[model samples]
Target: MNIASDIKPDRRERALAALAEKPDGVVEAIAGKAEVTPAEILEILPQGAAVIAGKDRFIDIWSEMTAWGTVLFIVHTDDIVLEAEGSLPAGSEGHGWFNIHGDSPIGGHIRKDNCASVTFVDRAFHGRRSCSVWFMNDKGSAMFKVFVRRDENRELIGDQLQKFEALRDRYAAS
Candidate 1:
């Protein structure tokens, strides 16, 4: 059985209702309140709000983001949220890991094999339009999130937004 499909109708309704009522609410907070994983939340989000692709697209997605200029790379846990602001470094696969090496502030090894899904999320965050790509593990937890950077006026960077939308469309179509 598909675990995501096992979520009760009421739970799905509640999640959707929460999004509708508080469009700017943080998804992680909503997931916590609704007792669902963030991945499950994304799955139930309204069409156009999210598009999920397979882990096999990991390298392709990351490669595309490398040219998006400065963006926010976030790793959130119960205790802390780590934010790194920089362009995604191009990565190479070797020795069971995807290693990122560059002059950027973010550089590390990612076990891409453990990634189950890559979700492109376009939602309102803190009352601002936000776009992010979430890399999620098999357990439905986000491994990391890369957000499109905003300008001084707090608007989504135009070119990056276009690129993000294009990527979402390309993957969502296939």
Candidate 2:
């Protein structure tokens, strides 16, 4: 059964229509205007656009991401979006938090226990192809997102893209 089937049909149709009209729009925003959750929107995305993996794989996935080179890490709330461009630092679990501390500018303590799933999204954003790894909480909200960075010509960095695709494929199968 479709995970979002419980939503009213009219509302689901409206959300689908909106997504079709604006495929690159921020999903959270689209879901908000349509009175749906971001995870629900993701569930209905065009085939091949999104793949989900259980949070049990978070550590392995995060470990691989540390080698992805410079990328964009985004943390957002209802009012603001904060972005950091750097290599993801290696992290370790201690005292109920995942401590991320290394030479990179990205450092913090993440509540890894709260992460419910990891979703790999390959889609367009602002008219350009983009790829991101979304860490989602149980409430259907994104805890944060790690986006593959674009180069000077506004193209996804090839190495990172390969790594991202490989990682997605590796996890999507299991």
Best by lDDT: 2
lDDT of 1 by residue, 62-156 (tens): 99999999999999987778999998899999999999999999999999999998999998788788999999998888999999888898889
List pairs with backbone clashes in candidate 2. none
**Relative to the unseen true structure, what is the C-alpha lDDT of residue 30 in candidate 2, on a scale of 0 to 100?**
83
Per-candidate TM-score against the hidden true structure? 0.91, 0.93
Task: Write out the backbone clash pairs for model 1.
Answer: none
lDDT agreement of model 1 with the native: 0.86
In model 1, the worst 10-residue window by lDDT is 1-10
User: Which ranges of candidate 2 are over 4 A from the true structure?
Assistant: 1-11
Model 2 C-alpha lDDT per residue in residues 91-111, reported as the tens digit of each score: 999999999998998999999
Which numbered prediction scores highest in TM-score against the true structure?
2
